[model samples]
Target: MPETVGDYLLQRLRDWGVEEVFSYPGDGINGILAAFEKAGNEPRFVQSRHEEMSAFQAVGFAKFTGRVGVCMATSGPGAVHLLNGLYDAKLDHVPVVAIVGQTARSAMGGHYQQEIDLQPLFKDVASEYLVEVNVAEQLPNALDRAFRTAEARRSPTAVIIPADLQEEEYTPPQHAFKHVPSSPPSVARSVVVPPDDEVGRAAEVLNSGEKVAVLVGQGARNAADEVRQLADITGAGVAKALLGKDVLPDDLPYVTGSIGLLGTRPSYELMRDCDTLLIVGSNFPYTQFMPEFGQARAVQIDIDGSLIGMRYPTEVNLVGEAKGTLRALLPLLQRKQDRSWRETIEKNVSDWWDTMEQQAMLEAKPVNPMRVVHELSPRIPEDAIVTADSGSSTNWYARNLRMRGRMRGSLSGTLATMGPAVPYAIGAKFAHPDRPVIALVGDGAMQMNGLAELITIARYRKLWSDPRLVVCVFHNNDLNQVTWELRAMGGSPKFEESQSIPDISYADIARSLGLEAIAVDTPDALGDAWDRVLAADRPAVLDVRCDPEVPPIPPHATFEQMKSTAESVLKGDPNAWHLMLQGAKTKVQEFIPNRR
Candidate 1:
């Protein structure tokens, strides 16, 4: 029997274990859509209001289930709408398959109403693209490759089936391959321990150095205990990168804080001044803080061999599992009480932590973003998923949030985009209804993509009893913190910096959709607000009107774009000057009484 390309596409999808697909119908995709609907309908299709929403929903599904999220859209504009979600999936390493239907093959380059080159547009975001010309002849190969690429790399891939091709029936050949993919390979790399002398040399340098710090990143997730063990053996303190938040519990005594601009002072200063720094599974970027070649001799331990010397000058590069490396170096490490160095750094780490809490988390009048995140973090179920949008909100949340080892995060690198967390929260909730999902987002970012889905999830999930619940903290501050950072790059100051403005009332927007909503302004109201939302057992939003002047991202926000911020600050404030003084104080205090 022969099958149309559209029909064959659906049959292959069923064989690939796709039980459901979230999508928006289009002219380019009608053939496949109908085929998917008719081929015994093993994988049900849920309709969406918009193509972008379909992509977002697909990403959510993938993030939630650790399976590939699939979506279908028509060519040109419809395919264009998917860029945002596609970028989200790519940046966050969420596996999704965007099956976009393009114009008929004959008019591909004749500028049809909806014809555009998708491969070029998708190359950066998708791991691989299957812009199939012949589904009956090419689908088996395309399907296998698309799914494999998406899963193995934890990235999205696309399969564009033209409208004309979808309607043509051809004798589909038997697929030579039947092996379903299992999972992506762990980034962990195995390496044999070094010779005894190398360990002895590393131990000698580590012990002899008066000041030392252990930096942990997501790389340390698998070797938390070993990292702590090494830290204890050397009497060294520990700090984590934002992604490494839970590598060590918040309660550990030797734990100072994370190191970065969106980080604490004590840990940052101690890290900069330490005589011997040990990087256990941390390929932390921002080498600016990690001074040039010999500021503090650094021992690099990571799963990737190439990453060892790639960032900064490494004194010793140990290529192996962090745990394995530490175990090998354990016997060779020299135990000593370098009281002077440890004390100097400890006082600095301690005082900095206190001051940060005061200035940021425990402020009196206006609410602090940190406190909101801190109060919320402990309250959410320990195992529930956490997704963060990139901005002041994430800096605040990442600095204070901790989800013990084994906790899942929908975080990507600095290519932080908004609207992702909201949809990601949706997908994660769908993925693990057994656990709660918390989405930390700033209004500027969240509004860019999330609100439209308010009505869609309810419509889609009613048939299958939706399990995912989201507590969205929508910070309503219309300010981009990156403007001041622009001034720091040797550019003349704009008298009216544009970082202090407030726009968007997300609470009102959310309430219209029949969901619980809370608006809070003061710090005291935060704890109760979060609690109320969590107890609702349904979709909820905590719209917080925060002080727009909050100083959050710089390393994360280096692009100095400002107009409103300058206007807001010049009219009665000198935030650039004020922040300069505050940042100066934060830096100087590091050398105070216990300043390492």
Candidate 2:
């Protein structure tokens, strides 16, 4: 039997060392489905309920493993469904290769069923690389370039294969005019180090400042040790961009927690007071949360030269890998003689954690959302991989959850999309089958798609060495984040019609899918619930009823924000009294001294 393009595609993916392809079956790619059976699923086809989930799982896998994630879908709607997740990958700077099916060539221009002009559709998302394979000869080069470009640019790339062409006999490109042949599959490695002159200038700026501050982003993951050394020499307080939350552990005395709207007081203070700033591997966009322009002399280190000085007005821009550039800079830096700045940062960090505890323990209608994460912080396994969905619950995950040991975590950092937490955990499981994965999701996100992905977790649990995948849902029965945004940002009362969501028992739903389940409505039960869920033999869901009125107040709330919230209350917000009371109780903790 002649090898079909579908068969060749799978063979090439295997040659590139792809272990799995997250996808769903569709007739547009009937050739690939047949090839999967003929090839004995060499590169496993891990199916998801939706193509979006498959793309998200690939993103999760890529993010955790530092490899290119691949996801496939059939033509039209199936291809359309992959956009959200692929956009998530693009925005967050993840490497992903999407193999999507297109309608048969003969039927493409006739207004055929499921025929949409795919080139324009994917032009933006896969802007790094997008090619349609018209002949078998184009398959290898097109696919290989997609992988190479995705890795080189750290962005999403795509290869479209027409349904009929996939079934045609495969043939290698001829050694003739107009033919392009690709080399064997392997990622080329290169080390980028900024010039010695640039590194020296950055060091000079660092040495001249009285209070130095370091901001680490996800790009700084590889340079954790270097970042620590830099911080130690300069006596700088390190603050993490949310995506870089795990870059440096919260346990570090000089490490302030997450920075931005969902940030901590210590992190806000670190930016506000520092005179010299060093940013590594993070392109955190919220410049307002950073040190005021011109107040601090800044230096940025990033592999991408384009993003180097875009965020802040940096005096020195180092275009190199964070680890290598920081390594060069460290040799030229002199240890700070003053210990006072270091002491102040440590004190601030300590007080912030105490305040987090106090706020987490405060009384609420049922469970304090902050306490849900606070309880899990100490109890979480040192090696656990945690994922959080976007919503009000993200505040707790960002501020309360402390990173320690070999733990890793992420969300849709740049996209800020919902429903990635559960799928991301699923991806994390595949990336490291031995590690336990936990997802902190809000009710709205769970309803959006996290609930459906539970079945995906249950199906794949046995494949993992450790079967403890816990989906902890904050069941507040509200679109809490947007509701608060309405009041805080828009000066408008929460319209119950838009803000309220269905109150469903997520635990019951999880049990129906043959997974362990637990429900906790009281603060006293949160710790025990987390313990049982973490210790479960299989995937589990912890559905805790959280307080909807608990405001995710910014660490540095401005007067305008306060005035807007007051206007919302006066305009008849449904939970005005509870919202104000909870806001007051939570904020008061920041000022209270920890007696313990």
Candidate 3:
């Protein structure tokens, strides 16, 4: 029996080592679905309730595994649904391959049912590579190329297969088209080292200045030890971009946490006072968080030359992989003997941790969310993978979680989308079955894409490799971040009911899905709930009713923010006092000197 076009595509995906392919079924994709079933689940097809959820899972998989994530969708609306999540992949620089089903080739441009022009639809997001497999014989090669391009560019790629052609028998291309048969091209996996002159120039800029600072991003993830070596040699205080939070151990003496509004006081202070800044593989966008132009001599290193000076003004630019470039530059860097600047920053870091501990332990009626993160931080296994949703919960996560040992993390990051946390944990769990996975999400974000994913977890649950995914949902029943943002931005905090959501019992929903779950309303109950969830040896959800009054504090506040707070308080905002107290608590120590 001859192979069908759909079978060939499935076989190629399996050959490419795709363990699971997320999809939402529709008529246009029936051919591929049939082929998937016929293939005996070699690349298991994981069904999602929505096409968007499928795409989100793909993005999460790519983020956690550092490999190409594959997602499939039906024609028209189903294919259209993937754009939002695919954009997450594009913006975050994760590799993803979207297999979209199209109407029959003959029906295209005729406005038939479920027919839409997919090439133009995906043009912007899948700009790296987007093509239709109009020719049945070219699919094997085109599918291969899509995966290769996605991996090489670390961007999303799309390949549309028309329904009519998908079931057609596979045929070899004619001699005219197949003049040569060659091996599939390999994606380059080696690191590129910068030229000696480039490294020397970067070293010269660093060696000439005192009070050096280093900012790292996801691109520097694998170069943590090298970054530490660079920091040690130059007496630099290291700050991380949020996406690069795990690039260095958070407890390192000279390591300041994140670098922007979601960052730390020590990091902000380091950015303010440094005479020289060394940026590694990060395009941290907040210029306000960096020194003014020419305030510090800046040196940037990245594998992509185009991104070298894109974020900050540069005195020297070295184009190479972070680890390789740092390795080459280490030998050339002049060691700074002065320990005063580094020691000062380290002291501030210590003081900042003390302040954080104080904030985490602050008692609140309905459990302070910070307390949950702080408690979970020490209790989770060192090798666990944690995912956080975008909201006020991210504030607690950014400020609290310690990325030590082999612990890993992922989030919506650049896209900063809500509802990726649960799907991200699902993807991460599938990728590393042996590692424990946890997701931190707020009530709003969880209600968006959370419940449907529990069904997914139950469907795929296994005895030995269950992943034991735990979802910690902060059930605050409000869009707390936006409410605080209104006050912080000087907008009137009136009509806040529009920003609020009805209190929903997410634990009940999780339990209905046949997963172990509990709802905890107090801080003391949260610890025991987590212990039960962790020990249950199955996927679980802990719906924590957190204090809605607590504010997500920034490392520093501007005069405008102060004015806004005063205005909101005067306007009779109910949580105004709580916000004020939390904001002051977060920053008060900055004004006091540490006796130790």
Candidate 4:
């Protein structure tokens, strides 16, 4: 039905509802690229600077749309480069389809250039589905399976096309392996409801304990109303995993912000003292942040049955979709009459926010990092999509940025990879140009993968109807998060110099690429810079010179951490004094206990 296998593949992609395909061109993929040019451009081809960025962009597309984001690369090196981002999709349970070109069939087993066994190379990452097309006839079924498996399993899938096969004419078989649909296949995500017995048992465990804490993850994002109802009925304090940042508004009374090192003080205290833990859709890896294995009677609910009780010992485990499972459990749950537990956690949450506000206002030589996020949060549009790179910027985003109303956003969740923010923002903008998209990245990550994507942004910005994407680069000139973790992990402050990055002007680099760029070094100018960037007509970058010395202090501190900070200061570290002032000033107030 098509001139070539390549054309057929592109047609299948369009039929599968893929509007854009992120890719990096190479000689091995020449045929597919040529076919894309000939396809009349309905499914637009986006050329990314790096194969990895293309994959990350695909990941971002999947994250924003909840559909199979498609990406393509050449054989050997280009295909290999997609592994990291593909793993990000797999580990985070996002749907993605990666098409990789291979050496011509005649060149196979002869060790030709750019020829590697891609099946084994891609097997682990695209664990759900992977196949190589040896002949033109195999293309349709393989492509169909790729999309279906990616959707059903919610993981990355791969289809490898040999260079020769891609150029050959493809004729549909009268007796086809599978029915090639005339229209787009509608993959329905059916509601998975756990059995009545499992639901009843979980409800019982939750009702038996007085102090309940509800921990949620990305799975519960769509069921915020149900989550709030559960928390209300059970007198539970809701603590979100980093991926579930938008599950509940920060202003919610019983919400404890986030959990773990990047979490809020109220979250730590609530987890430490809770009598029962009702975990919904989160396999929170940090066992230390949760109550002792058996200390709290735990009830865990998740769509994937294998993940239940993987993090904590559970008294009851319900295997089902979060929204349906939660809806089923709410009616069976006994509403806790005691408001004291809920009030205590809410009071702590309020105090933590107050402390954060004070820290945000503290004036310093270089602008305080928290101050930048503080200024930006209020200006974010209600429907904006925000992505944060993995580093100190994530710390500020996790602790400072507030997601309210219908606003949605995400990061490199399970992979926690850097260099995703910029590309993720680009993909999100492409997915929904009507909504504002922002990327919060640190200097280190910007140097790694942020700059190349600007070229991609510049290329496609005009194509977007409301291309108001913003890249907020935190120019701290160091891998600040790693430095802080080194100090917090009982290491000395003297080693920080080795990790220091050179002073780089991201705004200058952005301006060179034809993006409207501005650099703000002073605390006073940060707000105005953000306003200008938001109000700009095209894609822009706002580079803020953030303080490298300030550490992202965890909500709860250990004596070892305190000693580490003191030891660093005693050793004459230049930024140690500011760290001490920032950390100890409020700690005294917290430990002193207000004398009424």
* Models, CA RMSD each: 5.6, 0.8, 1.8, 2.3
* C-alpha lDDT score of every prediction, in listed order: 0.67, 0.94, 0.86, 0.86
Best by lDDT: 2
What is the per-residue lDDT of model 3 for residues 87-181, given as tens digits with 9 covering 90 to 100? 99999889999999999888878879988888899999999999898877678677877888899888999999999888899875556755323
Taking the tens digit of each residue's C-alpha lDDT, what string does model 4 give over 338-359? 8999999988887777777777
TM-scores across all candidates? 0.79, 0.99, 0.97, 0.96
Please, what are the lDDT tens digits per residue for candidate 1 over residues 110-223?
Answer: 877878898887777874555555545666666777787787666889887788888889544454584223222222223556566767777777877767778887667667
- The per-candidate count of clashes, in order, stands at 9, 0, 0, 0
- Would you list the clashing residue pairs of candidate 4? none
Over 4 Å off in model 1, which ranges? 1-4, 7-22, 39-72, 88-96, 127-135, 167-212, 280-283, 299-308, 315-353, 360-366, 405-407, 460-468, 474-476, 483-504, 553-596
Assess candidate 3 and give its TM-score to the true structure.
0.97
Which of 1 and 2 is the better model by lDDT? 2
- Number of the top candidate by TM-score? 2
The best-first sequence of candidates by TM-score reads: 2, 3, 4, 1
Query: Lowest lDDT 10-mer window, candidate 3?
Result: 177-186
- lDDT score for residue 425 of model 2: 92
Higher-TM-score candidate among 2 and 3?
Answer: 2
